[model samples]
Target: MIIINVLDNFQAALEAPRVLSLNSSKYFSGPYGEDIVFIANDWHTALLPCYLKSIYKSRGIYKNAKVAFCIHNIAYQGRHAFADFDLLNLPDEFRSSFDFIDGYTKPVKGRKINWMKAGILESDRVFTVSPHYAEELVSGEDRGVELDNIIRSTGITGIVNGMDNREWSPQTDRYIDVHYDATTVTEAKSLLKEALQAEVGLPVDRSIPLIGFIGRLEEQKGSDILVEAIVKFIDEDVQIIVLGTGKKIMEKQIEELEVTYPGKAIGVAKFNGPLAHKIIAGADFIVIPSRFEPCGLVQLHAMPYGTVPIVSSTGGLVDTVKEGYTGFHAGAFNVECETVDPDDVDKLATTVKRAIKTYGTQAMKEIIQNCMAQDFSWKGPAKLWEKALLSLEVAGNEPGIDGEEIAPLAKENVATP
Candidate 1:
């Protein structure tokens, strides 16, 4: 039903540019359906490329349009029973596009319809979030989630995602109580730290190293290992703050931290956008121990605020962080294991202790300046996206349809359908 709804709305969007205005003597003055390039992101919209190829293009409408499929995370590919293929309402000839036979030892055996596979097969271009993640997906079955071969054959590109510097910037963020750039970071962060400590019910001390963990508390985000690492530091002077909600077990564990080690730890198991800004602004270090990250945004958010990240070296975490310079590597997690490794917990705790040792040193100040100076804005990534999209133009066709110069469409022109 979602596929059908998306297809119907897509067809409507295709016809929108041709709609005649009843008040004026002109139609919508923009590129028509044939000039558009659709981008389908992840599994929810993965079927768009397949439908465009097998339905719209087959009917001679949107003949020149192309689809680029973006894989944010390959783990959650839309898989359903082969019998449910009929719900798609596609022709019998396209059935082969959705067919899959699982050969792995995992459960859910026999044939299934994999939407992400079809998207990769049908789309003109395929890409993931970060270059490292792109390589990880194609490296082996461990990171690929059973789609590595298809990803390798399709040839994935990686464009690291960008952060909204305006919103996340320390100098201009409206959410934060105080503002600071590299020059004033020390004094400003001290003030913000005191304020945040008071707000979260922790002891208001600016001298102690205040560490933060902000993300979904799940296995992927390494919440279990974070808890274990906190246990190792229960007797230490460092203070830790965690912001996010996930599995009830993880939430309970986080809440337990405050009770187990009063004045040293606090966890808020709910989403609070304003507090998030305050935490990033106030904390000395941000922890992102993701087991497998696909171009994490939290680390990017931390960098501009001079909050050094202590992250697991996997996927985009490896791409963005420079050890001992911008942040510390908490060591990589075992990708093949179903549960957290004790060694990973020890590594994270050791790294946190190392960071605490470096807290007020001259070297730590230099690291803060380096972190603040690093740029993760969208300007560079946007150009790469434009170049990638332009390369998808059909060989024989001119850049524009019917001699009209093909101006880049604004965000409003891109249809979510």
Candidate 2:
């Protein structure tokens, strides 16, 4: 076993993995026998062909190597022009699967191939971060982009991600001004909320239900929806504190709201980890109204803080947050029936209003306790991953070098390159 590190000073190319794929993978891939090559997310998966060709050229077709692809998000697929294929050093056979084609046309209009698609097809085993997200990627209306048919033909396994409890615990987190546990959460919340309000220049009133938004200011994170519903949120006497940055338009809108409704809405358009931790601790409820969340760690981070999450029922958020139990689920999708529509402002307003009304009540206290009580440690999820990997290893080595059982999967969607 050998590990080689390739370092490039070009930052721009690194951001666009497609540009760096060939060079990076050429350095990373090597000839090996009975080995597993695990690729992570779209960034590294863009180099699938490069890695495969390198390994196969040196080790031959029956080298007994299996590739595992782990998908964090189906969005943000690394797409590049067909011209760039020349640089990949791959055999002429990989063109069709790696080249993008428009699925809209009957004849299939050729566009740019999505690198994520290539990785999924090339992978011996596909794993997503959460079970619900895995199902959503394959079966639902909001399935993975241009790869659902292939995913259904093949199969994907989902494992719910576990949170790092030691780093995220409110009781022990050094980021927060106050240390708190489930028993001390209420009093700590009150003090921190007041302090946070003063710091952000919002009203330091303990009665107002302060909801926190700590993520990217993008459509997926529902930043636009939150901005749109600001008047309504203000109407309900709910104060909002947002900490993160993204789209300029959304940031402008948030900034405008802060100006429009002084002491009600505050947007800090920057990435500050300490502030994020403080927001999770101080805010009564953390809001995660993402359009499609694969496995959101924000809600997990919030749970242990006794900070209830108001989430859109999708992906890992749906799996983690129990409706009306530990947290509130805004009806972005019907969890039971698997239907989706644009989130309604009125519905979100109602949900926030309900949370505001229930704030500080015995019921809310119980819910907070439940949120804190729930376990999301890595122990179980790690074991599940280990078992899956072991099974794949066993399956791959069954027929020795003649490995026709697993070899058939390689021919899945590849056109004659």
Candidate 3:
């Protein structure tokens, strides 16, 4: 049987075999020679998942059991895409731990994916965070490689994400004024709404509905379309509260809108988790205007707070947020629409207006109730991994597997890149 380890270092999955860190295999294609799979996410900060999956395959690790990961943003190739952070200013505790790679600049290339590809190919399985994304990465070829073929050789799983209790709990929250849980959903909602409005300097008029738009302000995040839509809708009864900073033009427009529609539009150019949670609790609806979401955590945060979501139908949003249940679908194919443009100003505004109307119905209430009841925990997913590891068939390496029989995977035997 093959044993697997799940590293909690956020980028442990992305840095499978350590992409940013220098490696013996960085310049060479692998015949990895050992079995070890790393479950990586965070594509923006590291290599595309399959490259590493393939890296493991080439190494002959998968001859016994394939190595895999839960990938997010697997195919995103946008400009200035990598996360920009002060790596040098990392905390004293973190600094001492990562002394090996002080000048890490970039990850391995996707086209030269053999090293990563070999790992995945040799692996017993590869699990993705979103079923749709698993289907996407496993279906098409982009530049030089065929993603479909790469995925075919490895078993890909679509494991939906669960929130960390340490971070998302409302019981001991420091951000919200009131701390409550699923049982006190009603009281929590009301309190959060009032507190959020007051914090944002908006009126506490119980009659008006507030719309919460939070997250990074980028096209994938759906802020560009939202700016255009809000311009057209421009309603007095509906207030829009936005948290995050991106796109200078969008920020300026949001600022202008707040002035133009005093007490209606509030924009915060920063990420405050407690504030974000309160905003979710207080709002009538939450909008996850993502173009391609691979299991969004925000949609998860909103449902339990009784805030309906207005999202595009894609990735985890499809699995988690129901079309007409926990939230309404914006239904615009913002991406890959060559013939008909995704929603223009008029259509975007119309959709928001329609969703707002439906949000007030008893039917909407039932949908939220259903969403809250669903399980969003890691216990179930951990069990699935346990089963795969337990049942995995193995053998020692042979000439067929590169030389001697492929050895059964043990934690001590799993090698690094």
Q: List CA RMSD, all candidates.
A: 5.3, 10.2, 13.0
lDDT of 1 by residue, 1-417 (tens): 234466676555445534633433143344443566778899877777767767667888777888889999887888877887888867887788788877643335688888889888888999888899999999888899889999889899999987667667889887777888888999999999999999999998899999998888788888888898888875778999988888899999898888988889998888787888888899999999788898998889889899999999988888899999999998778774467798888998888888888999999998899999898987667767878888987433333223322334332210000
Off by over 4 Å in 1: 1-6, 9-32, 103-109, 394-417
* Candidate 1 local distance difference test against the native: 0.82
lDDT per residue as tens, model 3, 275-379: 776787788788776666767888776676677788877778887887775677766444532222445445556767877776556786676677667666555
Q: Residues 224-339, candidate 2, lDDT per residue (tens digit)?
A: 76666667767776899987777797778777868888778898887677778778888999888777788888988889988999987788988899988899977764332122
Clashes of 2: 4
Ranked candidates, highest lDDT first: 1, 2, 3
TM-scores for all candidates?
0.88, 0.80, 0.67
Candidate closest to the true structure, highest lDDT: 1
Give candidate 1's TM-score.
0.88
Stretches > 4 Å off in candidate 3: 1-37, 42-66, 76-124, 138-149, 152-155, 181-184, 247-249, 336-348, 389-391, 394-417
